[model samples]
Target: MILLPTINRSVLLVIPKQPFYDWSNKLFPDLEPTNMADIDEYNSYLLEDELFIDDPKGELKSYWKKIFLNELYEQCMDETTFPALSWKLFTQWFDFHRSAVVSDLTSDPLYTDE
Candidate 1:
C-alpha cells in the first residue's frame, strides 16, 4: 500500500515489512468498515498486545545490537525513499519509544505481598 497514493507521494509504491505506523483512519476514513465499533476496535489494534512486538536488546541480531540498530535507523531514515520518509521514521520511533515506556506497566506486581 506504500506505493499507492494512499500510502505516500512516491509513485514507486513500496510497503515495508511492518507498516511502522497506522493512520488509516486519519489518512483514509473511507477504508473503514461500515460499523463504528469495528472502526474503534481497528483503531485500537496498534495498542493491542500483539502489535507491540519488539526485539528488545537485539537478541534477534545474535548479540550484535549495534549493527541491527544501525540497519533499523537506515530503514527508518533513507532520504531517497519517500518525501516524508524521515517523518515516518520519526513517528515510528516515537511510537516504539512510547510503547516501551508503557510495556512494563502492570496493575499487579509479579511478586505479591503475603
Candidate 2:
C-alpha cells in the first residue's frame, strides 16, 4: 500500500510479515517474489509515512511507529548489520528507538501519507 504511511505498530503488526516473499509469482505476474536489491523499494517497503488525524493529539502513536520503522530501514541498508538481522528486526528496532519516537506528525504536507 504505497498510499499509506501509518507507521503505527498495530497497523504494521497486522500487515503480512513478508509481503514481498509472501507474494506468489503466479498470482502477481508483474510482482514476482524476488530479492529486493533495489534501494528505493527497500526504503518504501520498510518505512511508513507520518500519521495525522483530524484531532491533533490522536495521531501521536502513528508517528512514533513511523520513526521506529524508519530506523529499522536504515539499519537494513547497512549490508554488514542487515545480514544478521531477520524479519523480526522491527521488534529490536522498536525497542531501541522507543525513546526517540514521538507523536509530532499532524497534518503535515511534507510527510503526506501517500
Candidate 3:
C-alpha cells in the first residue's frame, strides 16, 4: 500500500500484490511503488505540483483525475483477469479518499463547535 499525503489528509493507494508490475505501471507509470519510503518521496513531488494548489480549500479534484484516467479504467475492465476485484478495490479506495475530504471539510475550524 502506498500512502499519499494530500493537503487535507493522507490517502492509501492499495495496489494488489499478485500483479505488482502491471498495477505499478497502471497506477504509477512515472515512479516505482517499492515501499513507504519511496511512496513518501513520490508524495512530495505530488504535493509540489500545481494541481495541489487548491488543496487547502477542500479541492482535491486533481487526485481523482490522476487516478481514474480512461486507460486505468479500461485496464481494470479487462474481462480475462480480475476485473471485478480491481473495480471493487478502486472504488473502495476512491470512497475512502472522498470520505476523508468530506470529513476534513466538516471538521474545519469554520464549522467547528469551538
Candidate 4:
C-alpha cells in the first residue's frame, strides 16, 4: 500500500452563525433562512503551516478579510447586497475552528485545477 501523503498546511474551518443567516435573509427575503444547527457543511481554508508559530491571533486577523468575503460570496453573489463588514462583525457572523496540523488520509494523488 502507498504511504499517506504529507500536507504542510494548517486549516481554518468557518461555520456561519445565526447573524449570517439573518443578513442573508434580509438581502434575499424570498430565499429560505438557515440556522447554525441546521447547517451541516462549512468551508475549510488551508493556510500556512507556520500560522500558529507566533502571534496566531494576529495571523488569523490578517486573513479574516479574504475568508470573510469568501463566505459572504458563497451565500450571495451580489457584493452590493452584503453588509459593511468589520473585524467585530466578522467574528460575530461565524464560528472558526483552527488546526495547526492537517492530515491527508487519502492514498490517491491530490490535484488542483489551478
Candidates' lDDT values, in order? Answer: 0.30, 0.35, 0.38, 0.83
Q: Write the per-residue lDDT of candidate 4 for residues 68-111, one digit (tens) a residue.
A: 89999988899888778787888899888888887788677768
TM-score order of candidates, top first: 4, 3, 2, 1
User: Looking at candidate 4, what is the lDDT of residue 32?
Assistant: 78
lDDT per residue (tens digit) for residues 15-90 in model 1 = 2222422322233455642332232221111122222235433322332233224434543444343334343353
TM-score of 3: 0.22
Q: List model 3 lDDT by residue over 1-114, tens digit each.
A: 954333544443333233433563555567654442233211111222233333522444444445444324544455344333344454443332122321232433433343
Q: Rank the candidates by lDDT, best first.
A: 4, 3, 2, 1
Task: List the candidates' TM-scores in order.
Answer: 0.18, 0.21, 0.22, 0.85
Which scores greater on lDDT, model 1 or model 3? 3
Worst 10 residues of 4 by lDDT: 50-59
Q: Give the local distance difference test score of model 1.
A: 0.30
Superior candidate under TM-score, 2 versus 3: 3
> Stretches of candidate 3 above 4 Å error?
1-22, 25-33, 41-66, 70-86, 91-95, 99-114
Find the 10 residues in a row with the least total lDDT in model 1.
5-14
Candidate 4 structure, TM-score to reference: 0.85
Model 4 has an lDDT value of 0.83
At residue 100, candidate 1 shows an lDDT of 17
